[model samples]
Target: MEVLRTPDQRFAGLADFPFAPHYLEIANAGGPPLRIHYLDEGDKDSAPVLLLHGEPSWSYLYRHMVPPLAAYGHRVLAPDLIGFGRSDKPAARADYTFERHVDWMSAWLTALDLKDITLFCQDWGGLIGLRLVARFPERFARVVAANTGLPIGGGKAPLPFKLWVAFSQLVPRFPVGWLISKGTARGLTAAEKAAYDAPFPDERYKAGVRQFPLLVPITDAHASVAECKAAWQVLAQFEKPFVTAFSDGDPITRGGERILTERIPGTKGQPHTTIKNAGHFLQEDQPARLVAVINGDDAA
Candidate 1:
């Protein structure tokens, strides 16, 4: 697999993203070992709080939430999945797959040997992270499922997601920053918007972005359908603490949290919330609230 690593300069001076990059080399399904980049901050010995970002975005999505989480004395970890951020980006759109992503990140987890984890997963983060939880249930202590899901293609994906899948494929340009702004309730500043665009120097660097939307299983014939079904069987047995914090305004995932609160045995009696005035990217719009949720101070 031919891979493209974004030049280091594009990431310079990214506003509110000051953490130094840390990397780990992990074997992939094929080709050379890929380098996965992550931000490891705060007390190294403390239990980990793993934050996973989703499509067309990277660890930059969690910048605001990181400082507070780290300062609260938890080891905060945020990784830029391969093909996004400073991580190696495979050249072809066909290089990315749902199973490959799961494997790559599974490798990352085993590499770090992280335990007692509190996961904050959004978008594709949940798609992949939730699978990890089902497969490695002992590694996690609790979970925060924010605006994401593990779909098995048993039914049609939400209409907005379907529209996004079509748009991502047919659109003339994949505007990463503008796409992020459109998803946030408060939107982003010019600099913050630029930060989101920093990972992709040009269109060629966006193969992962271009391919992510199509990976969602909106039909029974999709590649990862059976895998997600097996994951669901495992998830139904995941009895650890589970909670959902979905935004009130996201058309794409507004009602999707019920899938977790209803299915996960651990979600029973947890004070799951619907964050008001937020959109698909709740971390951007409600970082403080998210932090409070993480600290277990969002009571009432």
Candidate 2:
């Protein structure tokens, strides 16, 4: 697989993103090892709060929550998936796959040997992060699922999501920054939008970003449909403390949390909240509430 790494300079001097970058080499069976970048903050000895971002976004999405979570004496970890942020990007869209992502991240999890984890998963983060929970349930202590889902290709996807899938494919130029801004209630500042676009210098750098929307197993014929079905089997039995903090403004996943709360045993009796005046990218719209949810604050 031909791989492309974004120039180190693109990430320099991003506003409100002062955390240092950490790297790990993920071994690819038939290809050169790919580098995955992450942000590690706070007390290393404390149980980890793993923050996983989604498509077209990176660890930058968590800049607001990381500082406070770290300061609260919890270890905060946010990793850019192999094709996003500072991680190595494969040149071809075919190199990006749902199973490969799961494999890559699963390797990252075990390599770090993270245990007693508190997970905050949004967008693809929940899609991938929830699978991780099902794969390694003993490692997680609790979970906060936001604006995401683990689909088994069983139900009809929302019209907005269907429109998004079409748009992601049909758009001539994949505007990463503009796309993220549209997902949030308070649109990003120009600088913030540029931060979101930092990883991809040109269209070639966006093979992963371009491929993510299509990877969602929304239909029974899509790849990983059976895999997600299997993961749900495990998740249905997961009794860990799970909370859903969904935003009110997201059209795509507005009512999606119901599937999780209804199916996953872990969600029972939890403080599931509906964050008002926020959109799909609730982390950008309401990071403090997310931080409070992660910290188990009574007010959350």
Top-scoring candidate (lDDT):
2
Model 2's alpha-carbon lDDT is 0.94
Clashes of each: 0, 0
Native RMSD of candidate 2 (Å): 0.8
Q: Please list all clashing residue pairs in model 1, or write none if there are none.
A: none
Error of 1 at 29 (Å): 2.3
Give all candidates' CA lDDT scores: 0.90, 0.94
Query: Tens-digit lDDT track for model 1 on 1-300?
Result: 898898899999999989999999999767888999999999999999999999889999999999999999999999999899999999898999999999999999999999999999999999999989987899999999999988888687777888898899888878899999999999899999899899888888899999989898868978998998999998898888898899998898877898898898989988798888898988899998988887677582
lDDT of 2 by residue, 69-177 (tens): 9989999999999889999999999999999999999999999999999999999999999999999999999999999999888667788888998999999999999
Q: What lDDT does model 1 reach?
A: 0.90
Per TM-score, the best of the predicted structures is 2
**TM-scores of the models, in the order given:** 0.98, 0.98
For candidate 2, the per-residue lDDT at 295 reads 98
Q: Which pairs of residues collide in model 2?
A: none
